[model samples]
Target chain A: MAGDGRDERAWVRGAQAGSASDLEALFRAHWARAYRAAYLVVHDAAGAEDVAQEAFLAAVRALDRFDGRRPFGPWLHRIVVNRAIDWARARALRREVLAEAAVSAVPAPDDPPDAAAPSAGILEALASLSPEHRAVIVLRYFLEHTPGEIARMLELPRGTVNSRLRRGLDALADVVEQDGEG
Target chain B: MTDLRTELEFAPLPGEIEAQQRAWRVVEAAYREREQLPRRRRSLRPVLAFAVAAAVAAAALSPPGRSVGGWIQDRVAGEPDAEPALVRLPAPGMLLVAAERGPWIIRSDGSKRYLGDYEDASFSPQGRFVVGTAGRRVTALEPDGDPRWSLARPGPVADARWAPSPGFRVAYREGDTLRVVAGDGTGDHLLARGVAPVAPAWLPREGRTVLAYARADGTVVAVDVDSGARLLRTPRARRVREVFWTHEGLVAVRTQRELRLHDRRGRLLRAPAAAVRRELVAAVPLPGAWIMYAEYDRRTNETQLVREACFGRGPCIAIGPSRFFRGAGRLRDLTLSPDRRWVVAGWPDADQLLFLRLPSVGKVVATEDVRREFDPGGSGGGAFPRLAGWCCARASG
Candidate 1:
């Protein structure tokens, strides 16, 4: 039997009983995983934090409704994932503006920052990917979730997730190749 | 050259995930502190007793049958209107609300010469008329605040919305039945009956309206308002928070997860199912596009902004660390200028407005203190957030 799972379940039970202390314990226990999950998708610290707290809050509200048979971590992780997706959709306009600004601010090939680091170039490439493609890469690589896990988390078919993982890898190869050329 | 995905797998860009977890603990502690009772007890028994005595004396002294509204009018009826405050319009003034306390129509200046209590108030896209509910009364008022007409419905009027183009229709809830009134408040037609819905979302391109009913377990039901024919029913979305119809199509923000975009026929438009794991504070639709503002990374205390094309095929843009502050608070209620040039970012807790020059190089252009009504740093303290809705007008060429 998983002792940590029992403790997590106990904390959830305590939270359901109006125990703020238990809720805080639960937040401390699960917040990092949730934030990491969100960060892998949005790649933004602030947005990840917001998603983590909201996910925790949602978990608290629905704690009583939680079937004790299942683990709470996955359920809470689902909330974080959903919140990040909504945030991505809502900020569509601001991202456009930021991308335009970023494109304009990007230095030329011979700029001073060009030789700063190969890693920066990789980041730029990752950032330049479509949110969907970027998410697939982040889930498959950054978060280290399997195609099956990603498919279940995203509510897509396993085949779709596998194809996306493959295509995402191909796109990443292109990006890294472009950076090497530069 | 190493493949980017291979390298990313080997070494993830450091994002203080552990620190963020610690910060979330602090936030959770802070909320618990607020929940702790007897922290501060400032009683008003003495003040309440004195106020009661004064009210009794005033009531005894006043003449009979003189209502409070009447008495106030008698005292200040002839007073000149107050000077109009030069408050900046957030979104081309497409949506206008009187500065007065009640729902009475005030001339741009703070003067309530006309008196009509609306349960709620809204301005048309042109700002040429007002829509509101006053008890069982639903009325449309011209720009001058004069009632163009009023409709007395069967149920207590719940909510009223107007479509910007192709004519206007108002949705009202009477008991459990939902009804729609025409532009003139006539032809009191039963659009869909037995729907205890919060509000109806008018789908773009199509005249069909989507409403979430208790029967649908809060899953949104899209129906053609004119014909009452059901168009589409969204799957049972878990913890569905908000559904908005953008210029592109219908977008539903399901809690802290994915923003599903659906066409009028309810087909998923995007592939790979793009998702963000942040709690979205607010979303503002741009001209043929939309912007989402959300809080990110608990410890870092930053927000993210995302951009998506609304009209047709275009790549989705995601901007992270949009704004960062020392303290904790989520971004709420973002207002894009009518021209979509400026964005007013509101933080309900901070009661602060970050006036952003649209398209800033991934950073806030400026932050301003505009928290007269909103408590910039208070926890769920005021109704300003609820009353802080904005409307965008198509730019006039």
Candidate 2:
């Protein structure tokens, strides 16, 4: 995962003992994936930053009590995805409130999120699915968590995770005609 | 389905690097504040025990109730890597400190000179001089502790704030009355009677002599000291403790319960919504249109610092309530350096003075045994010192 993740345990031990450099190494290793996974689910730049930052802060706070033997990635990813889903759900409710306020609250049609990029086509399609469905898809494909792991991370039934993954994939299957890189 | 990980990993996000830098600093600060779980170091335990035994044996021979443990801790209270003392400031400004002895002027090089006994002190606009008040007396001294002028008032004076650029006037509280004096400590006249116990703030606009003070009735008023015209006044608010004016023409009023932003017209502007059960203790306006504040949680007993960036003058647009520093106990004296690069405050419970690097931090410098530093000879170390203000090389509005 992050440089074979062999160093993760050592970094956690060092960070728990008041080593800032070890903490930085851990943060740098996981920040990208944590941020991107949150962005894919929340679909807002600021929202993703908040989710990822909050996840990192939580990790730092729990560093003392954390068991270094356990993997840090899954723990951090669970926080990221859950917070992102919460943020997306909150934003959805805010949209409904603004919608009731006036007709002008509606945004103009966006150009596929990032029109010039070919990947935006897939992202636009993913954006259409519910945040819960997006979380399962993101955890499965993006963070590379297995169905069992996703269920545990999200505290959902494995069957529910699989159903959301299937529905999410079916939605994006047409949008992305070609896919590359494992 | 082919893995979309490759695309998701590289998708462009706006301000990613900036956000990472900002978030890393906040996370790092929280980590630094945390007391790490004691790690097993069996080899060093004996050595530490010997040292502790020696100290105890030395203390046992001393007078009853006086332990050398506190004196020892007063010498080494911070991290082993922390600088033994404040050798230099991260930013390029001078800091004014009110210690148990008196006010001390600390230059950029970290050298300090203590003025003779005074209870409180504040820096002039350009760091050219200082005005110190001690029990029925107010004295203006050069940075080198030479008296430029001294005056005896009928009542004790404190919180003397010099007006903005060209720095021609100073405002101080005499008894319950507010008064303003010329920069040379002459032409002293009463501005408002029966003012609150809060410090007065000068609106930092060039060529403008707008002075803001809270009334006894909880009304905050900004009046032109020269023309005696009311610039702005707020509806009665309770227990106004401190008033801070910004260069961007916004005044932030901090009461016991909440901190709020008011524009030049005195209309209360919407602030970043604070969560329930959190008490707002202090707020200081930064160089840009930004204000940094500390919120103390009653339930958790944690203090959190938040930074807000405001745009426009009146009916301002507040961009963020971004989290800055979170520490145990309360972080008091939220003072910003002149360059807006560092926020210096005292963490009382930790007995450490925190110098929080602004915007973001790869470097967090804290001075330990803060009380002892202010109390040299280390008898036992007085209460923590007050960070008067961080001033610039020259005066500016």
Candidate 3:
């Protein structure tokens, strides 16, 4: 999201005038966070690409209706993070159904966060929490949005945002203190 | 030690550049296509524009944990507005949904009433009565969720079903033994032993006392319950899961990986070939010469609904399986409507009950918030409800 705001505004104006270069620049500017934010939320490489692509497509369709005066980062990210959450929730439910059919056990909530425990424990630990918790953590730390900004972006209460952040950090506490090599 | 932010930024995101290139191509293509379209007149007031912007933002940013209907408003992308709740079914009929707590009767008008805390239930022939099983008790209940009669077996009873037309007998399984009782809940007697745990299928013919069930040894058998006559017995099928009987006298036996159609006399007719990693989860033979089945891919986690047209009652012509309606996760319990034009499948992965329009996708109407709608005051986080059966085939109720 860090870029020249004046240039971003000009790029939006040019893209609306059918300038492919401006559209490409605008895309490159937002694609990283959109893709990374989606990856952190959904935790699938192919799915992250899909979420990013769909969000970009949606942004293109809404390009004409978009007001150039407004920032594009939040608009594009709104699509990416939301679709990622939907994808994750659906996967969780399907896993629960599989567990039920095979073992007849109630689904343990990820409310507090895979057997695929990777050597890279941060993403794995992030995956341990529920999708809602993951979304807030990604928005706060990965995307660097303020608590109030995250609350508004996710349509959640500020208290709810803080609580989710607390729980999410608690889940990641072990890996947090360790160096990135862990 | 670095904090979580640095670790995340440094995380090795595989195929980042390749993904960006692929995604950019798609984005640029969409951008170009939209650029070529004719512009629409935008004469809206500022207030209307802001409202539109808010709706778009709400739709795009809304968390699925809050509202799945909005999350998947048009999941497969056809409808403009998907109902957040089951306001009404697309067609006129009753639906039976078996949640973890109990079974419920959703009427044609979208009004629902809980039947009871029974584990299993199905409507009687005409949808006037329901038979439900819980623990060792099988109770017959009126349409209003009131129990009319119950018969307790010595062990756990399951898969209880009523006889066709006039409803003279009710057949159920107690442990591994198949048992039958009169329609009035009297004259309980053992029908067979060593029965498979699969639910028995009753002959759809009016006043017919013939029933087909799988034995524990994996053979499908049809018997005349009245005279105790063994009508037909097929060679042992491998991992037979279900047996379905059509009104036209054709018996379809479904196994873990294949769907085999057999003649009324238990002769092997035909079957769809099994594909690797693609397991046939559920299949049902619809009257008027059509068989619909749901298949799941173990590798991809995609559930596909395929329809095959039959040349006759016994064996189907190899017109090939027409694959239609593929979605994420497992789409279980394919229940056909009275007209056979609609197939309802429970998509628990998304908390969605999709009514797959028949003959392939003319339209797919979905009802969301099913967990909350069916679970009443529960946290909406319990086991996703199962579609027990579609009742009142003709909506006489």
Evaluate every candidate with DockQ and list the scores: 0.05, 0.10, 0.15
Which 10-residue window in model 1 chain B sums to the lowest lDDT? B76-85
**How well does candidate 2 match the true structure in TM-score terms?**
0.55
In order, the interface RMSDs are 16.0, 18.2, 10.1
Model 1 iRMS: 16.0
lDDT of each: 0.49, 0.71, 0.72
Which candidate number maximizes DockQ?
A: 3
Worst 10 residues of 2 chain A by lDDT: A108-117
Mind giving the per-residue lDDT tens digits that candidate 1 earns over A85-169? 5444323433444466786465422122223223465566665555456666666665556778877665557887788777766
Task: Give, for candidate 1 chain A, the lowest lDDT window spanning 10 residues.
Answer: A108-117
Candidate 3 residues A1-182, lDDT tens each? 53688888999999999999999999998888888888888776655776676677666665776889998887676667766765565455445556768853654432212222134567777876777789889888988888998886665679989999998998788554563455
Model 1: residues with Cα > 4 Å off, grouped in runs:
A1-182, B1-86, B97-119, B174-176, B193-197, B204-216, B251-257, B269-277, B296-303, B309-327, B361-382, B385-397
Specify the CAPRI tier of model 1.
incorrect
What part of the reference interface contacts, as a 0 to 1 fraction, does candidate 2 reproduce?
0.26
Each model's RMSD to truth, in Å?
25.0, 24.4, 16.1
Better of 1 and 2 by TM-score: 2
lDDT of 3 by residue, B1-397 (tens): 1567976777778667777887776667656655554533221101111011212223233222233334334333211223344645666678888887678776654545566568999889888889999989999998656689998778999999899888999999999999999988999999999999999989888899999999999899999999999999988898888888754577889898888877867887776577879888877776566788888898977777777765444446535437667766677888887666777888766567877666654567766555755643223567788777786666832
Ranking of models by TM-score: 3, 2, 1
